[model samples]
Target: MRAGVCVILAMGALATMPWAAADCNPPMRPPANQRKFASQAVDSIIASYQPKFKDAQLGQIFANALPNTLDTTVFEHTTSGELAPDTFIITGDITAMWLRDSANQVAPYMRFVSQDSGLFSLISGLVRRQARQVLVDPYANAHQLEGSPPSPHTDDSTSTPAFAGTRVGAMGPTIFERKFEIDTLANFLHLSASFFAAAGKDQPTFGAPVNAAGQTWADAAELVIDTLRTQQASSEEEGGNPPYLFQRTTSQPTDSLQFGRGAPAARTGMIKTGFRPSDDAHTLPFNIPGNAYVVVALREAAAVLSALGRADTAASALALADEVNAGILAFGVVNHPGANGTVLAYEVDGYGNSYFMDDANLPSLLGIPVYGWTNTTDPLYMRTRALLLSKANPYYFSGSVGQGTGGPHDGLDRIWPMSMVARASTALSDQEVLSVLEQLKGSTACTGLMHESINKNSAGSYTRPWFAWANSFFGGLILDLAETRPHLIFA
Candidate 1:
């Protein structure tokens, strides 16, 4: 039988109970099998740390450091039930589905999916829900899935949902609120592609009968590609066409261009531009991270298309991927004194004027290796990574608690994000990895729960308490260490 069939059969016993309604309660006297798996996971994490924490004092310190359930107060809405998924929200302090966060949050669990059918089911359900959301509006990257009404405090009013014509799926009353963030969309594509590749199955909803769900996701991805090809910018109200306008009515202004009136060539790789990965508008956006993500997405999309027997679509995606990659290499790199050599800038003007600082998000210079864009040992990447993690990169900050990257989403001089720390550890040496682990263990305000962004000087004042991305990132890092360096645990 197929994987889905087998999963359904295994879950047959629990079918009568509302599995969806179950909170992420601590595993209740977990079965021997599950305890064994958890033990393996823990052991793997410890082993990975062995090379880093070999010092007798540090070893004990690290040994005492274990990842625990930070806050059970946060929950995910697995079904159209009353609860929400206990996950992390981004810096903006909104409870919603971040395409990027959702993917990264579940990444660590992929290893166990094959062995643990139940875990696989939960992940599969999340993917299906995301696919459905994409179909609803391919342009939007973030969403509010809880069916709650809009609040006056919302920043981007353009995304507010109306009751009519909204498609509610596994998660109830969800609406598309955040628009096309190339990075988030790219991550979504990557996750979907990876899941399909691993499971060796087409998306469960690919041809299934659902309320325009499959078509929506496919069309949205296509539209995103089209937008990138044309370099579409803001609507007339936001500032008309090409040069691009980035305006956030409620936050600190990042750009001065009247939306779409800047340099044209700089905007070449951009698609259907509106808000950025930070959910802020782009003034003259040929955002480096966004483009990088697009490149990755197109490559993955090509694979997915080919897998589904759509060779033509696959070819188109490949061509687009190449185009974006070429454009980025041509315009995104610059010689910076801060980097001590040529490095990837945060944002660039095709002619000149490249932004040097890094954002806390993935595709960041710090995240290149983590995102699998390049190997960690690549010379250019290593130099760039060193600069990004140092004081030279204006966004890099350190405090008594820990050190990591920060971004415009939060504020200047803010402490780094736990997400960045987790990602950094994935690509660092054993020594560096231990340093990050020590920092992370000290940075958490609520014992072990990850927060949005911590204060640069004070670890006590963190930005958000209920963040799923940070928790997921920490979990993912543990899994990575378990897989890559097993000795770190007990050494």
Candidate 2:
């Protein structure tokens, strides 16, 4: 039976049934609406696994497991005019739904959309909000509310208007303002395209461009793609009206260009003109993951354009995708001096400098297959995966709990991100997958709540407690295991 239908049946049962009276601290009965809704939600998840559980004894365990496994509530938004409540945000820990995170969070649910209208609606709402955010600022790695504008800052200045009162600053003076992070934009575009493709729908309820703000989001996405193709930067030299410049009020240098220009030495390649996927300023700029995402985005854009009947635009996007793929294969893959074999370098200098670490983000080495950028069994990907999951990669760390990818974004020697573990498992099998699962199950700091980054030695010393992406990722991993390795669960 369909999961949605099962949920309605469960809801009917819960509504008619009376709860046993309890002598607890203030005996309480949840509102009828909440009780029915929660029961329905639990039932929907349980129904998805009903095929695997036939015995009444096993069915009870399966039914009870639904509440613990369902982190769907973490995605909910409470305030008015905000995204839907079921749309997962990264909690108080990250404070934003990274375009990447939003995409991954809803990705697994796409399979069930046809079976569950409520779940499909929730996913659709999330995709619409994400598309709107992409339209807001394609170059931005993150964004705040629609009512707020980003603060302006310069290369040398440290003070800038906070986005939703959250501080907005980067590392060096030359890399002062956050540049358009190509990877994030690509991820957003990819997700938008994927949502349209999977849901078999066109654009959401965005109205005609009668107002400036109404047109701004779509306009920005076009501009962002154009900027990437043309290698545009927030520069005063090419007409001072670039919409991407920022200047910090404090320590603003005399030579610093206000509207979004970076320091002089920072500009390197066509790739050097943007920020890293991590939202940190790139040291060399020609970021591997960013370029990989560009390839994926272009491919996705081509499909979207074709779906819209823009054949010429689709062809152009496909051509760009091919070009990016060629560039990545040519420049991004290289032999490490110590590692002997070639691995995907993190960042590349047009002049031969390459960094060899992975970050815990999509398009990172760990997420290549998860993002559908490459096949998991591809020879280069297999080699790169081996390197990334090992101590040979500077970011890889092994602890008593588990071994997985880490990065400078959180701290040195941190264990694997739960997201990374989930992605890694999705890509591979055998001992590596089992080990990652074991570590991840142990790494949940708040009982079963997944965190951003956990310390290598101690499971409790995690970074973000409320990160919904990690929780959703863990939930996805569970679902994947249920589907792929049913025997493991039974065994």
Candidate 3:
């Protein structure tokens, strides 16, 4: 579930270390049989690294986190015939699965899919599950595991004619929360292509029918493309009301969009998003990183569709990606009053309004390179990275304990470990990466697992004690470091 506290104002900043020592003996993981799922390949990974890490604390952290999702959250079912198996993953504190979080939770296991058939089936099954969810409602971000259950958030109107009335399933118990986040859809597409590339499996592996509704991965991809295309219209272009509208009855101002539709956006070619990946409502209609992510996700979708012989759909995906990329370049870049060069705005409206702060979520400006949207050396991304890490970006915080981006999602004076992971993943040098890792070690509050957002001054104070996405992402970072710079861990 999305963390509370959407207040955008950052309070006074202070720099001091939180009193949380790294536990030499971290809590042991749950017993093997008690684990929700297990894999020999993942066991091999932990065994291989445990002896190699020069820092035992980091090693223990890796061991606990790398398998956190499998150990605690995953539920898998295997079938005997042509139908692909089914898997449903809960986003740690929440019983429902978020398309975005579930994908990231299993991402690190991609490499091991071929080595462990169990792991392969789990990931492939998740792909099919996502397709089913997409077919259920492309506008929904979080979804329930089974038949429509009671929803937690206040009822919102999804019945209006918006975005071609594609938000039809928006008002059901099947969807946990119906916030239209573009990255949620994009991540599904990326995961589909990534899964195929890793497993070397196709057709019955993915294209086989998933439900009686005739839902398949290909059908989901088509709907996602169409939804994105429909959202590219400006208010004037659409002629009447915007295509999507979200309203949640809550005291939090950011909980609901103004007048059901979000801030008005001109036709900038970028697809408008109702909310960010954080599940916070957007200050502006167009989310730059979200659009950039769509570009990459679209290209990945194109690859999968092309291989499946859907040339027309594949071509359409590629064309949409190009149009979105062009839109980002033309409208997302801005002259930063506090920076040496122009940088990418975090969010923008087609009609000259923009928000500059970056949230500590995936698809952030600082994570463009990490997201495969751009390279570190790209002048614009480099400039934006500097600005985001400095005082220029309101959400960025520095303290004696750690320094990183936080978002309005968790309010002021907080730093998210996910941002630090993104920083390390995108860093240029071994020292730079190590610095971030050291901060992370101290910010875990001796729990040995990652949290949603920790207090910049006090690591003990944080949100979402059981955030599996951050844990898995942190584990993935360590895997990457071990593979590329062994000395960082081995020394």
Best of the candidates, TM-score: 3
Query: In angstroms, what RMSD does candidate 3 have relative to the true structure?
Result: 3.5
What C-alpha lDDT does candidate 2 achieve relative to the native structure?
0.54
Give me candidate 3's TM-score against the actual structure: 0.94
Better of 1 and 3 by TM-score: 3
**Mind giving the per-residue lDDT tens digits that candidate 1 earns over 1-491?**
00010111121222232222323112222244433113344345445664565443333323322322212212342433321111322322355567776677666556655565445545565566666666655555666644557632244323322355332222224543444466766876777677766666644523332243225345545655665665633233223322222233543454222332333444444443454556555544577767877777788877776767668767878888887788778777778877667887777656566777777766566776666666778877777777777877777886655577877667675665654563446455778776676566545532345567776555556666555556656666655565677676444
Tell me the number of clashing residue pairs for each predicted model.
38, 16, 3
Candidates 1 and 3, the one with greater lDDT: 3
Residue 171 displacement in candidate 2 (angstroms): 18
Q: Give one digit per residue, the lDDT tens place, for model 3 in 134-242.
A: 9887888988866646877636665446365344424666778888999999999989999989988543666788767766789989999999999898867865555
Q: Is candidate 1 or candidate 2 better by lDDT?
A: 1
Indicate the worst ten consecutive residues by lDDT in candidate 1: 1-10
Q: Order the numbered candidates by lDDT, best leading.
A: 3, 1, 2
Query: Model 3 segments beyond 4 Å from truth?
Result: 2-25, 80-83, 160-169, 201-203
Residue 98 of model 2, lDDT score: 65
Q: Order the candidate numbers by TM-score, best to worst.
A: 3, 1, 2
For model 3, what is the C-alpha lDDT against the true structure?
0.85
Report the lDDT tens digits of candidate 2 across residue range 1-491.
00010111221232222222221112122343543223344356767674464332333323332332123333353323533322433323443456665666555565666666565566655555655555544444554433333423333333333555444444232121344567766766776676667667443422224123565224434554665765523132334333344443443132223344453322233333445554545555577777777777778767766766667767766776776677677777899765657888888765566778887755677777766777888888778877777777787887665567766566676664654554545555656665665455555432345566666666556665445556556656656667787654434
User: Model 1, stretches more than 4 Å misplaced?
Assistant: 1-93, 151-176, 213-217, 232-248, 254-267, 270-273, 419-423, 426-428
Error of 2 at 316 (Å): 2.8
